[model samples]
Target: MDTFTELFGTSPLIWAILGAEAAFWILLFGGLAVRYLLRNRRLSTIMLIGVPVVDLLLLTFTAVDLAGGVEPNFSHLIATIYLGFTIAFGHSLITKTDAWFAHRFADGPAPAKKPKSGPAYVRAAWLEWRRVALAVGIAVVGLLAMQVMVGWAVPSSFAEANEDVIWSMALRLLLIAGIWLVAGPVYATVFKSTPATDTTQRVSPASDTLSNHR
Candidate 1:
């Protein structure tokens, strides 16, 4: 117990967040397994419902830790990011996973392939970037709320540590948002023009041959 506390520090919220993350995946796959393999929709619904409950549990843990005046650490930042991304993207993930499970276990249709290139790909990329933006926004809001709760004072070592941790987290989030924007939207926009160049090159040979014959 002493070692465990030492490893995670005095706050149990870190451990709780870890457990919640593990529980989320377990419940997701377990629910799908029960639904498709065992053909038990009722039980599966119960298990799948438990997935969001796990998120709530993590939120509660974070809130309690902060309320108790625990110093903000990496774990708190992680909790905020995790919650943000999960809230923003969890449903899509669950739907995609369920489709795969259905195909594998229940003889359902195969999942549709994601677009790889062209306008479709660009649109998908933009859509994904929007989701990334939403997630980042949520995370920023969460960090701000935490700061508000803890106040802006640095009268003590804990307050200074908290400020440092929060600043690092904010910077990390900004880096992520910027990278996603460039990689997803900017790259996709550039890639969308490549097909036009390739098509023009392919047609240039035919145009030269026709002119020579004339």
Candidate 2:
């Protein structure tokens, strides 16, 4: 059995690990640039769907290669980090990147709107709190999924296990919560009305974009 160390050289599984890291980063930054250029958040919005799909496919291939040619390490630590990121950034791209752009790029004035926090607001927050609680939970689940998948690959006992289904759902909820958590403040600050001044600050063009998105 050629362990990942022997196949890849003195370093244990370096190529496999590095390859995965590089792929993840490339996809992340690539998506960022893409969303920025497109001037539409939905491209990133679709990343939530596309990323995990790609990751799942990649993981399947990695596992086959690892079993045939490498080792995910005898300890499953790498799997956790690898899979955690796939889920996190995948989720973030979908839910939070728009917020990221909004917060970073917002420099305009908002159109006037009444200040109102209705019951729907409270209800939305209440519903979302449960989702926010799932961020770490989703990460944990993803880590566990990696472990489970690795376990199955070794023994060929792969069951659907309902875990991936659960993860898909949890990751989405986590993404929504995370986007709101970071972007919420940005939304509040960027969109909220400021008193009209004698000196008058007109809306920044970028702010208009942000407001339109909101």
Candidate 3:
């Protein structure tokens, strides 16, 4: 355990890898849940935000290893394959046909008749931007950026000194924070709340108050 912990530390790459694995499990179970319990046609989406992180981690790790650190070994190959599959799988989870089409539109309260529409989402906050493909594009871009950064910053055959490691940690944390900050506003701007009705799509103050009441 101690050795494994040392190998991993809290590097963003590791975090991304961990997140990816967690997302895979979450997605797998989420699918099963939706199928058996949720009844496949339900229009619920899963939040495996970790998918991007994993993809980034894999790219970075591969870069580091190839740059002349430890020669690629069996474990390395295994990881490579794992990350590859995760990226493909994760991508599908975020943007898939069965996810969007099935269930005859789930049991959503229905899209509310709204006053205005913008950026597609704020037009209907009650309805998530998950339906939009652009959000997935954003995630893909972020993941690629992270992957390049890690590859350039740290060489596979190289390990940083304590101070450099600390700096790396700080940078990774800053990135995570930045991504969330940016994503929040984007998502908010895209997802607006409207009136609540089976036909009216929106998340209103009434819903909030009602949930709180419950």
Candidate 3 lDDT, tens digit per residue, 1-214? Answer: 6886666543444454566677666665565456546565343343334445546766677567545444333234334445544544456555453444333345434333434435444533423333233333343343344445445344343245223432333344346545654464355564543323367667799898999988
Query: Sort by lDDT, best first: what order?
Result: 1, 2, 3
lDDT of each structure? 0.83, 0.52, 0.47
Per-residue lDDT of 1-214 in model 2, one digit per residue for the tens? 4675554455334455566666655666566656676665677556434556666665565456555644444223344445555564455444465465445555324433433344444444444444444545654565455556555322222243333433334445456667776555444444433433356678999999999999
Ranking by TM-score: 1, 2, 3
Q: Model 3's lDDT to the true fold?
A: 0.47
Model number with the top lDDT: 1
Model 1 C-alpha lDDT per residue in residues 51-89, reported as the tens digit of each score? 889888888889888998887876788899999888888
Colliding pairs, model 1: none
**TM-scores, one per candidate:** 0.80, 0.38, 0.29
- The top-ranked prediction according to TM-score is 1
| Clash count (model 3, backbone only) | 15
Which stretches of candidate 3 lie above 4 Å from their native place? 1-19, 27-50, 66-68, 94-105, 108-214
Error of 3 at 85 (Å): 1.8
